[model samples]
Target: MTKDTIIQFHNVRFCYDEVCAINNVNFNILENSLTAIIGPNGGGKSTIFKILSGLLKPDDGHFSLRKGSTIGYVSQFTDFDLSFPITVLEMVLSGTICKKVKPFYRYKKSHRDKARNAIKRVGLEMYEDRGINQLSGGELKRAVIARALASDANIIVLDEPDSSLDVEAAADLYRILINLKSDKTILIASHHLDEVIDIADSVLYVKSTVTKFSSTEEVKEKLGGGIII
Candidate 1:
């Protein structure tokens, strides 16, 4: 079966203070598939993400998402203060802030149900009441993912989600992502491809530009040497 194109970038170019971050970038992302964005440091992966997340506008060319689509973005480094007094459930509930009507100081019953369901989906049902700081690294990452889910996003974009996780935890994280791939379009940016290459349906190699490869083997062969994310 052929999947619909959920996102498209045609000769897209983005810059920051006269410094070109990504140029002549073009790619099509299929719906309900997992795409891994892999590249070296300072290679414009972050810039591409910013553009997709509506944080930055392209200086030239065109970028488009399917109409009525919503994006849920998880940054490489979360700015949330873990030390703050916030429970996992509360954090997930915050994801629905954008959906609240006027006088948004209070949340409706539907919002709480969504948050609780999201936590369960991520396998954090038991930790819903735990303080963010008290959870392990893997557990905390799951909480963040739950927050994205609670927002009712069909497209989920994650940046270095496996960062700082141990080998076992990283493997587990990929398992969770693979499970979610059936219902959501998943995009992940990582400096290392070893973790995601096997699970990703396609690979986007970005280095001041973008190219789509069907598999890791194709990317490695094109480079003509060892695999380098």
Candidate 2:
């Protein structure tokens, strides 16, 4: 069966001030597929994701998502302010605030249910009421993922989800991501390609341009090493 295309980038280009991040980039992401974007440190992987997450506009060309599609972003936990006294449930609940239409928006019972379910999905149910600062590295990562899932987004974009994780924790994260792909279209940008290569349905190698690979072999052949620097 042919899957529906979730996102399409047609000769997209973006520049930060005078520096071009991505130029003439093109790719399409299919529904219910997990795609890993890998590249060098200064490559345009971050640009591609920023565009996808609606955090930035393309300076040129076309970047489109399926009509009415929403994106949920899971940034690295390190990007969060851990010192803040916020519970896991509260963190996840904030994800739903973006969809609020009223000037004085309030979360409904259904929203809380979704947040609870999202926490369960990431296996963080036990820590739902725990303060975010109290969680370990792996648990914090899962909490952030749960926050994204709580938004009921059709596409999930994660930036270096395994950045600070140990080997076992990284493996655990991959498992959670694989399970997520059964329902959500997932995009992850990681320098640790080997960790995600086996689980990803496809790979997007981004430099100033983008190329899609269907298999790990092709990615290995193109990237030169199984792990991207």
Candidate 3:
């Protein structure tokens, strides 16, 4: 891989049982650039996200991350048991727990400080100590993003961040993502074509196959008579 390349997928293929999740995909995510993976439903968008985040491995092909690269991931919101008490601060700090760190080890002061800063960055300072259940939908999404930022990863990947968010909330999240692109390579799996086209430095269009475009117009051209939205 080139020095500018932070993540590379060479002829990658992935499958789950009988379903083909990804098919012979190849792409390079440039350092410090914002890339958006956009496609229709069942277009293998989430599968690609999983592959890049290391949550799932490809069934075939080669995938590589640059040496010493760190990755942070923000997943979609799911049904959480509000009764399982956990503070927002604690949830964000959990990102700092490295693989080498023992589960029994307590988080240090530095970890707490980082979590606080992350929460502040996402404009959630007042909600730091609140229970996870207490946050509204937008607030919960911001808190999850704080956790990702707290990870301090070189590459940050988010899955459907705008899901279930109102228009204002989604716009706020997009602004945060645009700001973060300067410091970290940002990749998102989104169905929000307009938002993605506006901020993305490159576009990854996933279908039965995967294709990468350097510009929105290029992506539209390749869509071959299909509307971008």
Model 2 clashes, total count: 0
Provide backbone clash counts, one per model: 0, 0, 0
* All models, RMSD in angstroms: 2.1, 1.9, 2.0
Q: Put down candidate 1 lDDT per residue, 134-167, tens digits, no spaces.
A: 9998888888989998998889999888888988
Which ten residues in a row are the worst by lDDT in model 3? Answer: 220-229
Residue pairs of candidate 1 with colliding backbone atoms: none
Off by over 4 Å in 3: 79-83, 101-103, 221-229
Q: How close is candidate 1 to the true structure, as a TM-score?
A: 0.93
Candidate 3 per-residue lDDT, tens place, 94-128, comes to 88777786767888999999999989888889988
- After superposing candidate 2 on the true structure, give the runs of residues whose Cα lies further than 4 Å from its correct spot: 1-3, 98-101
lDDT for 69 (candidate 2):
83
lDDT of 2 at 67: 84
Candidates 2 and 3 compared: the better one by lDDT is: 2
C-alpha TM-score for every candidate:
0.93, 0.94, 0.93
